[model samples]
Target chain A: QQPVQSPQAVILREGEDAVINCSSSKALYSVHWYRQKHGEAPVFLMILLKGGEQKGHEKISASFNEKKQQSSLYLTASQLSYSGTYFCGTERGRQGGSEKLVFGKGTKLTVNP
Target chain B: DARVTQTPRHKVTEMGQEVTMRCQPILGHNTVFWYRQTMMQGLELLAYFRNRAPLDDSGMPKDRFSAEMPDATLATLKIQPSEPRDSAVYFCASGLRGNEQFFGPGTRLTVL
Candidate 1:
């Protein structure tokens, strides 16, 4: 099933901080985050695999809680380039399911300079 | 840097026409995924292949949409008797097992 993302849209100024949350009803083995600019493909940001582990990319970070089947992407000191749509893909820990991802609807973020 | 490549970045066809899209995955990547994006449905997985074999295509429309990986490097999606609703940005992604998928510049299809 598709995951649910909070804050359908957000507007922020440069250097501001924002948090986007994704929650899945089914148990998730991993969470993958990507950012997509207008007219461009989704670019990989980071992935949080194990539960209770936090991963960071430059000023962006994410945390995954396996028990709750939830993940949050944190953007600190946001830059203008950070303006885009954020999507979180979840992978179920099925026996043979390797990387089949079910993605969320995505969060639209606008960061103004 | 290795990246996925897709052919015919834009496709426009009339109703009842046939449309085909192609993709060349990154070398040595065993998994290829096909996705369709629309304003209402968001991003939906149409099909996927692993090691040149189809694993799951349950999301695809069996009647009109078909996906195939004839070789390790090539994947194709074809639509027959296309309808206006089929217009959307189609994306092809390739990746290794348990790793990040590299998406190609999508093909914007417009069926009139």
Candidate 2:
């Protein structure tokens, strides 16, 4: 099933902070975040595995709550380059089977100068 | 750096025509996925394969759509008698088991 993303769209000034949330109805084993620019393919940002772990890259970070079946992406001191559509792909159950990822509708983030 | 590559970045065809899209996954990756993106449907998983073997293709329209991985490096998605509603950006992603997937540039297909 497709995950749900909050705040379908968000506009922010450079250096501002924003949070994008993704929630699933089913239990998730991992959550993968990606950013896609206009007319471009989605780029991998980070992946949060189970165990309620948090990961970060530069000013971007994400937290996965396995128990809550939710994940939140944090962008601090956002840069103009951060303007794009962010998607969260969720994986359920163990690996080795049909480990296909179901993605959310995506959150459109616009960072202005 | 290794990256997934797709052929025919853009394809325009008339209705009832046949369209084929190909992908070359990153070396050492065992899993390949095909996804279609549209304004209404968002990102939909069409099919996926692991180690050149199809794992699941229930999301694909079996009537006109087909997906196959002939080898470890090559994967193909074909649509016969395509319709205008099939117009969308198709993406190919590859990854290891339980790892982050790397996506290709995507093939923008427009069925007129």
Candidate 3:
């Protein structure tokens, strides 16, 4: 089953902060986060492995809760460039086991300058 | 800066025609995924291959759609007797260790 993302859409001003959450029914080994702009493909952000692991790039970071089967992405001091749609993908188990990924409906964020 | 590459960025075909989309994954990436994006369904995983072997394709309609990886470097998704409802942006992605998925620009298919 596909993961569920909360807050289908949000609007924020530049320098603000926002959080996007993803939850899955099945146990997830890892959660992948990405962002995409209009008329463009989704861009890789970071991956949070199970076992309470965290990964980040720049001002974006994410954490995965294995027990809860949930993941949250934090965007601190959001910038105008951050205006885009964010998607979270869940993998059932470790790599080399399954190549399939279930993605959320995506959260659209609009940051105004 | 290696990236997944998809051919025919945009394809427009008549109904009942055959449509094929190709993907060239990043070098050394053993996993490749195919997804379809629509307004209602968002991004759906159509199929994926591990070591060029298809693992699961339950999300894809077996009758009209088929996905195959001919080699480590190439993968293809084909649709026969395409219909208007099949029109959507098809994206190809590649990843290592299922960690970070790198997506291509996507092929926007329009069936009329």
Candidate 1 chain B has its poorest 10 consecutive residues by lDDT at: B94-103
Candidate 3 ranges beyond 4 A from true positions: none
Better of 2 and 3 by DockQ: 2
Q: Provide the TM-score, chain A, model 1.
A: 0.92
Candidate 2 residue-wise lDDT, B69-94, digit = tens: 98897999999989999999999999
- How well is each residue in B43-112 modelled by candidate 3, as lDDT tens digits? 9999888889888898899999999999998999999989999999999999876467889999999999
Docking class of 3: high
Candidate 1 clashing pairs, residues 3+ apart or interchain: none
Writing each residue's lDDT as its tens digit, candidate 2 over A1-113 gives 79999889999999999999999999998898999999999998988988756443555688898888999999999999999999999989765586778999999999999
Clashing pairs in 2: none
How big is the positional error of residue A87 in model 3, measured in Å on the Cα after superposition? 0.5
What's the distance in Å from true for residue A94, model 3? 3.8
- lDDT string, candidate 1, B29-61, tens digits: 999999999989888889999898888898899
The full ranking of all candidates by DockQ, starting with the best, is 2, 3, 1
Order the candidates by lDDT, highest first. 2, 1, 3
